[model samples]
Structure formats: structure tokens, C-alpha cells
Target: MSAPPRVPRTRPEPVAPDPAVPEPAVPEPTLSELAVSEPAAAEALDAHEEHAWSRCDPWSAALRSGRGPLYLHREDGTRHPLDIERWCAAPDAADRTVIERCRGSVLDIGCGPGRFLVALAERRLTALGIDANPHAVARAVRAGGGALCRSVFAPLPGTGSWHTALLVDGNIGIGGDPPRLLRRTAELVRPGGTLLVETAAHALDERLSVRVGDGRGVHGTAFPWARLGSTALLRHAEETGAWAKAGEWEAGGRRFVALRRA
Candidate 1:
């Protein structure tokens, strides 16, 4: 038989890229191909902080692309459509089950546009979202959803907060420092609280790191800016001493883990 599949030996560590190998030049994407690709993930932030460009710029092109499904927090401050509505609207038994199991307040880390928060609010559960983008926060508020304008690594606005916090859409990348990211998340979660994380496709180094910027910007093996993967996520949980276990959803091509403070 061919060699057995390579199980992860240990969590993959992302060392900084060497200075000798210049960061690749990511070409500005085509403004014309908005229909072909899905949008990339972005934590909400304010307008001025975001770049002003259209289809020609890497960020805007990627945002407008149909490459990956997305929930847009429009630059115009109006509620744009979100591709995640299908799932967020009709949470499967697995997700509903998790919701039913949750106790006390809830928070959605990197809560983009308050989609989850609004859904949870409908369920009559107390919920909030915290994202790095001020523009996103404003849109969320305008959308009549509640969320915080802050980065994941920053301290939460309130203490001894919620019993359950979510990190969905491969959002485990809270600054490319998984261990510290986990520790901070755990701290934000109160005693007996649980952190529910949704992970990206596995064997992360290549498939996940293909973020093409202007080619002049920094390229990272792990996301110091955006989403991240399972290895770094699990490793961070371990390092932070959070009791953790992963649940793989093979049919959906995703995996999620729940970690609780021990």
C-alpha cells in the first residue's frame, strides 16, 4: 500500500519568514472578475482605516470577488448582503444543539457585521460581537446589532464576561500568535465558559497562506492579519491550558473545537 496518511506530528509552528527571500509581489487583482471568486474574510473596522479602491486593488478585488462566500460590512454603512445567511439563518441541529447547550451571555469573536449576534438575539439569548474594524462595528450597530470595536488581542470592554464565545470562519488567527490568542480568549471567557472555534481546511501551510496582496506587502505563513488553521488553534489551546477537544464535520469540510477553562 502507499504510505499511510501523514498525521500531524505536532502543531506546526510558523516561524517568521526570512529576510533574504523577498516577499512575493502579489499582483493587483482584476476589477472585472467580481462574479468569479468568493470574498475573503475581514474583521470589521472603521471606514478611514480601510483602503479606498475598487476592482484594481488587491483588497477590494478580493472583497468583491465571489471566490469564497462572505458577509459584507459595506463601506457605505448600509447593510449589505451576507452569503453566510443560509447557515446563520438556518443553523443545523449541530449548531442549534450548541446554542441550546450554551449558558449565560455569548460573544462572537471577530463577529463580522453582527450576523451571529442578531441571530442569537432572535433566540432571546444575550449576545455580542467584538471585531477589530470600526467600520464593521458601526455597520453592525446601524444594523441594530450589538458589538464591540476592538481587536481580539485587546482586553474586552467588560470583565467576567459571557459563558460561550464563538470564533467562526477560520477566525482562530487572532494576530498569528495562536498561543497568546487562546490565552486571551480564555481570559475573556468567564469560569466554566466555553470557546467554540471553527477551523479552516487542514494541512495549512500552503492552501491557506495564498493571500495575494499588492505583492509588495507582507506574506505570512500564518495569519497575523486574517484567518488561521487547526494546528495553530489546537496548539494554542494546549499552551494556554484550556481543556479542549475538536469535533470534525467531514461532510461540511470543516472542523470545530470547544475549549473550556480547566
Candidate 2:
């Protein structure tokens, strides 16, 4: 397995366009703009699609889908229909309440553009977000939020230190290594901390097994991402003896299960 460390340590350059691909008009979107302006999000996503079609990482462009937490690059130097908020997990009022109940600093894994962190911050919680994709992290940082351009499975600056950890967007299977990923997430959060792992309560087959390609693509198994439903995930939580189910909720089209120390 050539899986790179999931620690938030490695620094990579943000994705840019190739000469073969002409840049499309994708003006950056502010968090507020993205939050309320669905039309703008839709437009930006279309531009991303265009960029992918232009051969920016051609293989990934071929794998590009208009859905998921992925942002694609098209041939016209534009990105595609971006799924700002994915289908299964939604950071709605329920998630907001759970975040408010957090005891200390919070860590949001797979924080894309820091939208969730920004929302968490509004509630006066110290939150941090990390992602493997430099572009996403950079966007979050540029938008004035605390986001790291690194992987979640890698060593964290402050390990076993946070009171709350977020693993929404079916992050339990990050890097397609479920057990290691769960253990690593546990290591990052304090013993009594809560790791809010979200997935499809009904369609979980896609969340358990991941199949990432290269260092720049994503293709998880078709499982619905039910970390809560998996016996292995349950075992991982028990073996750690650090977390137990604390909170859970469902909205839009997903389910969330928050695990904390017993």
C-alpha cells in the first residue's frame, strides 16, 4: 500500500491550471455567498467541470462526477458541478447543537473551504479543519478560517488533545483504511473527546471501504458509509476505550453518530 501518511503535516501546492486549459470565469466565493447563493455555488461548480475537461489531471477528469465531496477540473480550465455540501452529511441545526455542546477545541476532518469551521466559529468555538487537498484547504484559509492543507490520517500537531473531533462526510474510512483511520482519529482527540462520525444510516456500503487513486483522486466503494452500522467500527470504538456514542441525528439525506469516551 502506497498510502501517504494521513497526518496534517505534508504541505502541497494548490491545484492550478495547465496552458492547454483556458481559465474560466470562476470568481472566488465567500462563505456567506456560498451559504445562501445556491446559484453561485452551482456556477462555480460548472466552471470546475470545465477545467477538468481541459486535461488538468486527465485521469481524474475522467473519474470526475458532479456529486460527492470532490471538486473536479475540466478541460476548459474550469471546475465542475461542485458538491459544496455532500448528499449524506449535512451540518444543519442538529450538527450545530452538537458542536456547541463540545467541551474544548474542535477538529473538523475533511474540512473543505472551512465552511463548517466558520459556522462553528460563529458559535464561539475554537475549531480547526484539515484536508488532503491543498486547493480546498487554501480556499478555507483564504476565506479567513483555520484550515490545514493535510491528510486526516497523518500525525496531528496536537494529538489526543481535542475535546471534539468532526468526521462528517463519511471520513471514518479515510484513505480506505478503516481501522487505522479510526485509531488515528481517536489518537487526535482527547480520551473523553467526542468524534462526530457521520454517514448514511441506510445506505452504508459506500462509507466503509475507500479506493483512492494516485494522490489526487477519490473512488470509495459503493457502500453507503455507515460507520455506525459497521461491527468493525463499533469494535474500534470499544477497543480504544476512549469513546462512546454521545450524540446523533439525521437530516436532508444523511445520518450522524457522535462517539465519545465512556
Candidate 3:
């Protein structure tokens, strides 16, 4: 009888539900997906160590003296001198020639310090310069030119709409893949648009993984780069099927090729 009474008085306690587990975080947008303008996006990706040459202060003595000790250490154990002075200097006769060739909306790939871009702007041409080096971009902006710290391989503002595209300052060696770079330029330039590229004077086509060095201790990370002569550039253009040789010229001991869409 007492057990029965106790059971009747007893009541079960309520149990609390476990807090719901939070869902996994969503992944951030990629560089392409951001769809941001070149300048803004470029600033986000800017890294000083990635492009040591942009910082001209450390190399001021060498750059100003036109005797830069900067070099590119190739995989073959050879060191190729990099012309930091020319790149940092104002536009010369040869640079003017390249600028004169630029017509309609111009897109300068690897536009170091924006010398050509500034010239284009002075002429009132719709021009945009893109470089991966923030310091270079800053210099360009300071000079009152439109420039962005961005890579040519990244998403651009006017893909396939640019009337003229440039790959000067040995930028044809970019990424160490001439064919790929040519194909990319083709994609960037519209039908009948022109692609002006600078090449080595010799007839060699070589690709090497290299790093930038000041010969004083400062060095950058290794990157793939190529050096193609006029002949090799023409061959690459033919293989791409997106371009045809329009003209060729030499300036300041450097060679250049002009290609137009088929």
C-alpha cells in the first residue's frame, strides 16, 4: 500500500532539448567571383614581397645611376640583368612609338610605372594600365594616370572589347608560356583589335623559372617566365590562330611585333 502511494505521488522531470548545432560557414568568394573593379580588387591582392621591383627606394642608388644590380636568377644557374632604370624612367622615344601605336580603348598589360599609360592619358586616349605591383600602380596614380594593381590573367574590365592591347617591357615573358599568353591576349582583344608585344632581339625561345634579386640579399619568390624572339613570337601567334602578323619594329634595341585578329 505505501509503495503504491509513493508511485502515485512521483512525477517524471522534463528533459531540455540540446541546442541546435550551427551550420558550417559558407566559403568566401574567389578573386573572380568578387566581380570588383580592377583598382579595388588589385589593392586587396597587393603584396610587397610578391613584387620587390616595385619598391624603388631600396634600389634607388642603382636605379638612378642606371646601373641597377637587379637580376633574374634563372633555373640554369645564369643571372639575367633586369633593367630597373628603364622601367622606372619616363617614356623615351621607343616608348612613344609604342604609345603612338595605341588606338581606341587601350589596355596595357604589365604596365610598369604607367609611363606609357600616362602618355596615353595626356593624349586623351581611353587607356587603362594594369600591373601586379602596388608601388607601380601608386606611382601611376600619382602621375594622374589610370592604373590598377592587377594581373593580366585575372578578370579584366573590358574583356574582348579593348581596341589595343600591349605587352611591352618584356612582358611577353609573363608566366613563361608564350602560347597561353597569346591566347589570352586574343581573348582580351576584339575582332580586328591589335596586340602589340615586345620580344627579345635574338631568335631564341626559352622558358625558365626565375626569381628577382638585388645582388645585395633581397630576392623574390621564383616564378615561371619566358623569353621569345621575333621569330618565336610570330610562330606562337600563328599557332594561336587568333592573330596574324600585322607589322614588326625595333626600338631602343628592343624588338616588337604587332598582331591583328584574323
Off by over 4 Å in 3: 1-67
lDDT score of residue 172 within candidate 3: 90
User: lDDT tens digits, residues 1-262, model 2?
Assistant: 2222222232222222223322222222122321221112112222212221112232222223313435433323343333444422335665565565554566888775566776666555556776554445455655455765445644455566666788765566554455566677877776666787765455434323222222345432221122344444555677766667665676555566778754
Model 2 stretches astray by more than 4 angstroms: 1-82, 85-91, 94-98, 203-232
Q: Top model by TM-score, which number?
A: 3
Give the number of colliding residue pairs in candidate 1.
14
Residue 259 of model 3 has an lDDT of 95
Q: Would you list the C-alpha lDDT of every candidate in the order shown?
A: 0.48, 0.50, 0.69
User: What is the C-alpha lDDT profile of model 1 across 1-262, one tens digit per residue?
Assistant: 2211221111111122223322222221121211122112122222321221111133322332323233222223332233444433345555554555444466787765555666566665556676554444444555555665555654454444556788775556545445666777777776667788776666452112223233444221212233446665666577677647534343255566777755
Tens digits of lDDT, candidate 3, 142-182: 66656656677766767777778999988898767899989
Model 2: worst 10 consecutive residues (lDDT sum) = 33-42
**Higher-TM-score candidate among 2 and 3?**
3
Preferred candidate (lDDT higher): 1 or 2: 2
Q: Candidate 1: deviation at residue 14, Å?
A: 43
Mind sharing the TM-score for model 3?
0.76
